[model samples]
Target: MRLTDLISPDAVFATLKASTKKQLLQELSDRAAKLSGLPAREIFDALLHRERLGSTGIGEGIAIPHGKLGKVKSIFGIFARLERPVDFEALDGAPVDLVFLLIAPESSGADHLKALACAARMLRDPGLVATIRATRDHDALYSLIAQRSKPYAA
Candidate 1:
């Protein structure tokens, strides 16, 4: 699945302020609830459950917090660039400024993994991430994510 398949222009946040990981997840869940038609509490709980397993903070100031829900029919995503980096218990112990929250249907299985891989592949590029962080314009951020990201950047 492509990144665009999970995210849209409205889902892209250029400058969100989150002081802590828990608050960030809660905010993401609230945003996702509006777009995904799922309850914010359920989404927050699912993300919390996933975090309990391990931090999704995948390094390079990025965190991809994801979860699955029975009510979801397809994968949905929310991306944010924080105004100030927040501690996410990243593997590299780096505070995260970039975040992507992915929510998928409980039965998605392989499709969910593929969507995660797609987002990870796109944002893993240092050059692209730099460009994303360089602009605060909502439309521009959306454009860069929608247009400039490489299909797979390792």
Candidate 2:
């Protein structure tokens, strides 16, 4: 799946402010609620429950927080670039500055995994991450993530 397929221009954010992981998740949950028409508290609780399982912080200053919700009809994602990195208990001990929050319908099993894998692969590209971090323009960030670009740079 392509990033553009899962994320919309309105869902892309830059230089978001959050001092802690919980606050960050809360912000994301609130945004997701507006986009998905679900209760913000429900989304927050779902994300919190997932975090209790283990940190989604996949290292290299990135975190992909995801959960399945019965209220959501399909998979959707929100990408946010934090104004400053925050402690996420990342496995590699790196604080997270970039986050991609994904939520899917409860019945979307295989589709959810595919979306997660797609987001992971995109963010794993160091060059792409650098490009994202270099700009605060929401439109540029959206293009960088949404465009079907060439091979990932090393």
Candidate 3:
């Protein structure tokens, strides 16, 4: 699945002030709740539950925290660039600055995995990650993700 297919411009935040991994997930979940109009607490709780299983940090200063929620009708994503790096227990043992939060319908099966895989593949590109880090506004950041995720569309 294309990143743009799941994320709206409103879900993107340019400057996220999360001092730690927990706070970062909360911030992202809150944004997703706002966009989806679901209870913020419920979303936060669901995402937190997923994190408890394991850290979503994919390494290289990036993390993709994802969960399934009953209230959601489709997959949704939120992108955030933290003002400072935070320990996310990443595989590379490095802190994370860029985060991608994904929420999918509870009934979704392979689609959720497909979306996460698509995001991970897109984020694996160093140049694209650098470009995303350089983005100074939400619109620009959303555009960058949209552009990068285009090639994977099927």
Candidate 4:
């Protein structure tokens, strides 16, 4: 499925205030919980559990933190562009400025991996990432993600 299908325009944060990996994950988890109708603490704990396994920072100013939760019915996503880069322990050792949080149902196995792959592919495009980073408003960022993610739609 497309990332836009899981992420609403309202859920996109154009100016995230977080400046550290921990804070960024907490903010994303809280947002995902509210959007998924689950408790923020529960979601936060799940994300933390996943992070303990390994850092999701994929480098090039991008990070994808994902979790599989029993409470969710389907995969959900939250995109955030931080106002300042945060030290995310990325593979390339660069700070992250863009974060895509993916939350999926515990039962979704292959689909969850596919979704994460799609997100990583999309964010890896230099042109697309540049456009998204240059976006000044929510609508523009949403539009960019929607257009870029169309090819992966189910």
- Worst 10-residue lDDT window for candidate 3 reads 145-154
Predictions in order: lDDT:
0.89, 0.89, 0.85, 0.87
Of 2 and 4, the candidate ranking higher by lDDT: 2
The residue-by-residue lDDT of candidate 2 on 8-111, one tens digit each, is: 99999998999999999999999999988899999999999999999999999999999999989878899999999999998999999999999999998888
Question: Tens digits of per-residue lDDT for model 1 on 2-120?
Answer: 57667889999999988999999999999999987889999999999999999999998999999999999888899999999999999999999999899999998888887788888
Each model's RMSD to truth, in Å? 2.3, 3.4, 1.5, 1.2
Q: What is candidate 4's CA lDDT for residue 105?
A: 88
Off by over 4 Å in 1: 149-154
Q: How many backbone collisions does model 3 have?
A: 0
lDDT of 4 by residue, 1-154 (tens): 5788889998899888996788888888778777778888878888888889988999999999988888898888999999999999888999999999988889988888888998899998999999888886988899888878854643
* Candidate 4 or 3, higher TM-score: 4
Instruction: Select the stronger candidate by lDDT from 2 and 3.
Output: 2
lDDT of model 2 at residue 73?
85
Let me know the TM-score candidate 2 reaches against the reference structure. Answer: 0.94
Better of 1 and 3 by lDDT: 1
Q: Which stretches of candidate 2 lie over 4 Å from their true place?
A: 148-154
